[model samples]
Target: MQAPQTKEEKQLDISLDELIYKVRELKQSIAGFIYKLENEYQHISWPNMMEHFGVLSSQLNSVKRLLKTSKMPLLRNYVLFPLRLSPDRDLELEKLTEGRVMAFSHEVVPDYLRTKPEPEVEERVQMMSVKASSMAPDTTQKQLTNLNKITANLLDTISVPSASDEREKDSSLKNALPQTSSQQDTNLLIGAITKGHRLLRPEPQSPMVVGPQMGQMQPQMQQQHPHKLQMPGASMGRMPSAIKTNIKAAATSHPYQRP
Candidate 1:
């Protein structure tokens, strides 16, 4: 059986219940603020957003401390069980509360302050673009000037030949032997002189017995003295004596007189 509750216990229970109710109300308020901030985030200021979060954090801390110190087993378990069961709820709550606070403070504040665009910045960008466009013509002119200079240099190089080229032409002219009428006459005179020298030189007499004449005479001689001719062995042995006799006969023969 359960014993009856004391006055102190009843008061503690009542205070714990009040604390729990206050925590619930605070959580609801924070949720409402988060919803409002989500919808109208751009409009809200940083200080206002932070103030709301600070109040909520203080209330939550107060509630947590109260719950921790409470001796009521049912009250503590009832409040802590749901929070412990899903740790994500606390994280989500923190994200909803503090996350928006930081986002609003850092992100939203700067944007809110400078909602209107700066005329000077826009003008500066326009001026830079205009300057770049204007510079293009000057750059093209410079390029054209360089091209003209290069063309002029090329023309000068082609028109005026180098000293080496002039020297080559002069050397070619000097080396070429000219064929003037006087030079041709001199060449003809030298050829005439060479011809006269050749005419003055003594020439060797032609052989009396050529190869073809000797061949023809051999057959005729054989026919004329067929029986008188000695055998090859006797002719070889008596060749010198026969030659001496023929020479003596030719010398004794008469010289022919013209009638």
Candidate 2:
């Protein structure tokens, strides 16, 4: 049988349900706004359209903040919350919220906010149009010529680097990079070599055989070599001839010098 949930787990489930309710409310609010935008304000002017966009934008941000602050991992997984009316509704809500936010930012807001030649903008547009219609063809051509000259002067004033300047910049970057890289490479190589030497270097071998058996061999070794017994903790059995030769060779050899 499955164990019952602790108090904390029960509280967490309650909080998560409350969070889902808030998200659902926000989603309904966005749906209502979209409905109004489509039906009530089918041909909204710039100012009125922006006011609607602002309300929707603020609602979306609040939903985003709610999702962020909830700190509940299960809310992100659609499969976990099967108790809801629609198991996949939370995922759909997230997608709808994101889509609305993007639509407002990209399509509706930018188009409405941009300067357009609207009749309500000012009387200047009408005046300009009337003046353009009354102007002589030769005089218009002269004005166009002057405008082109002014644009060309502006373009000339915007400095662009020459091929030589680009080449110099490329060469300087290339020169600076190699010196630093070479120094770093050399240091790394030396460090690797030093580490290898330290790892491969022979350590002083301790006598493997110890205790009672080793103690028993002391007297026999003393008779064979009396002077050697004077050394402290000296083992009585001399190491095998082959092992002695190998140990001496290892001790004498330098790590850098290959065998």
Tell me how far the alpha carbon of residue 156 in candidate 1 is from the true structure, in angstroms, after superposition.
80
Candidate 1 per-residue lDDT, tens place, 1-259, comes to 2335576577667876778688778978888898979998888899988888888888888777766664544552332222122313345545755554333334344454464467898899889898877787879799889999999999887855553466677665544435445664564456336433111212114444255544444654435323233433324433444344575566655366334
Clashes of 2: 0
Q: How many residue pairs clash in each candidate?
A: 0, 0
Candidate 1 clash pair list: none
Taking all chains together, each candidate's TM-score versus the true structure is: 0.26, 0.26
Error of 1 at 175 (Å): 99
Which stretches in model 1 have alpha-carbon errors above 4 Å? Answer: 1-12, 70-259
Against the reference, the lDDT scores of all candidates come to 0.58, 0.56
Where does model 2 exceed 4 Å of error?
1-4, 70-259
lDDT of 2 by residue, 72-122 (tens): 545534433223233222555457666443333333443544555566656
